[model samples]
Target: MSKVRWKPGNLIYPLPAALVSCRSKTHGDNLITIAWTGTICTNPPMCYISIRPDRYSYDIINESKEFVINLTTTQMARGTDWCGVKSGRDYDKFKECGFTKGEAEVVDVPLVNESPLAIECKVVEIKELGSHHMFIANVVSATVDDKYLDDTGAFNLNQSDLICYSHREYRKLGQKIGHFGYAVKKLKKKPRRKKIN
Candidate 1:
């Protein structure tokens, strides 16, 4: 195999397409579809979302310092793309997208009711990283839909029909290949059958 050289850029494929909701004193409620989002830390439960300064929700989140990261699904693919393209400056995203505003436990910002999971976050720091500014936030609370909970009380996120963004297209998640550490996990051995003598 041979490799081709190209311009330096972010070419990481297949990122979770998240719908981030926020509000401010002047802006009211708004939703912004973000592909550039991820978990940053585990202990304190932190995450980040990078947004361009010109985006309508950028000011809303920057001033409010709070938002909810709602995981998207295949059902929400069209709306997610719409929210990203349309600006809250003219359109009421929640109303336009028909997204229900679910009340967050700790933060005043609202989560998307249709979402299987919602993570409430408070901005801890902001870094001006060129074209997009990164908002580092601490996850204050999270709400999971009871429908996705298995009988064993484990969250079955795989069953939610979630979608992700790759290149320039949105695609539904495929089959579960394996879990973490499965490469080194020992498989259980079956018991030997008793001798029939």
Candidate 2:
């Protein structure tokens, strides 16, 4: 096999396409679709979202120091793409997207009711990195839709038909081959019965 080299850039594909909602005393409520977001830590439950300074929600989040990260689904593909392309400065995203504003428990910001899961975050720090500024936040609370829970009360997120962003396209999740620890898990062999003469 041969390898081709290219200039250094953000080549990572298949990232979670999140809808980040924010509200300010002056700007009201707004939603911004973000692909550059991910969990940063486990213990304290930290996450980060990078947004351009010119984005409408950037100033709202910066001033409020809070936002809700709503996980997107295949059903929300159009709205997700639309929100990213259009600015909240001119449009009321929640109303235009037909999404109800659900009240968050820990923060004053509203979440997208259509979302299966909403992660409420409070900004802890900000880092200016060229084109986009990063908002490092701590997860204050997370709300999951009860409809996705099984009889055993386990959250089946895969059943939600979640969508992801890859390259310049939005794609749905594929088949699940295995779960965590399945690679090293032992398989049990059935006992053979002795033949009777």
Candidate 3:
């Protein structure tokens, strides 16, 4: 089969559509639905979200240096889309979208109580990349819904109906095909039965 060539672009789709909440010490809170966000580091537990400087939430984040990344789910698709299209400058997103504004564990930003998981982050660095500025933040604390926890008290995020963004549409995550390193890692097994003959 032949394929048509296209210009180079950031066409990477199927990304998590997170609702990033931020608040200033003076102003009220706001939520910005961000699709340009992802995990950036491990040791420091960092992540990054790219935002246009003109966006209303940009100033709040720039001044506060902290925000809460609320993981959205299929149930929150309507609110997620609303948060992205509407301007926080005029609308109270939390109230208008019917989402609860809960207190954050580590940052001044408010977290969405309805979200299954919320990660509080503090900005560590900022890089101006043309049209958008990437804010690299370190995860200060993570709060997960108790209902999603397993019997062992471990958080099971996979069980949540997580939503992702692809080509301007929201998509729910699907089944897991494999675990980390399952493709090439040697599997542990019961010691080979020793022949006693």
Candidate 4:
């Protein structure tokens, strides 16, 4: 096999494709498609989203200190891509993309009701890094569609059909290969054989 080295750039693929909703008093509501977002901490439930300062949502989120992260699905690929390219200053992305906005539990920012999963976040801190600023937010509340719940009251996120963004393309997630500790965790031990004679 042959390999070639490439320049240092964004090589990480398969990031969650999310429509981040933020609002301002003047602009009312807006949505920005984001791929640079992920969970930073689990204990206090923290996450971070990186965005350029010039983006429309940047100012809104900075001023309001809150936003909703709406998980995207395969069905929303087109809308997600469109929102990323189009600026909120020119158009009402939520209305144009046929997405419904519902009141967020923690913040005034509206959540995308069309999304199967919506996470309401409150900005805890901000870090300015070169081109993009990172908004470190503590997840305030989350709302998921009841239909995604299993009979045992377990949330089945996979059934919601999540989507991912790689480079500049949108892709749907595939089947689950294994659980958290499937590789190392021991399975049920077989019953020991009874003593012979």
- Between prediction 2 and prediction 4, the one with superior lDDT is 2
lDDT of 1 by residue, 9-109 (tens): 89898999999999899889999999999999999999999999999999999999999999999988899999999999999989998999999999989
TM values, all candidates: 0.98, 0.97, 0.92, 0.94
Candidate number that wins on TM-score, 1 or 4: 1
- Please report, in order, the local distance difference test score of every candidate based on alpha carbons: 0.95, 0.95, 0.93, 0.91
Per-residue CA lDDT of candidate 2, range 1-197, in tens?
A: 99999999898999999999999999999999999999999999999999999888999999999999999999998999999999999999988888898989999999898899999999999999999999999999999999999999999989999999999899999999999999999999889999999
Question: Which whole-number lDDT from 0 to 100 does residue 12 have in model 4?
Answer: 91
| Number of the top-ranking candidate, with TM-score as the measure | 1
| RMSD in order of candidates | 0.8, 1.0, 2.3, 2.0
lDDT of 2: 0.95
Model 1 local distance difference test score: 0.95
Residue 21 Cα positional deviation in candidate 4, in Å, after optimal superposition: 0.4
Instruction: Return the lDDT, model 1, position 33.
Output: 94
Error of 2 at 45 (Å): 0.7
Q: Residue 97 lDDT in model 2?
A: 87
Give me the displacement of residue 177 in model 2, in angstroms. 1.6
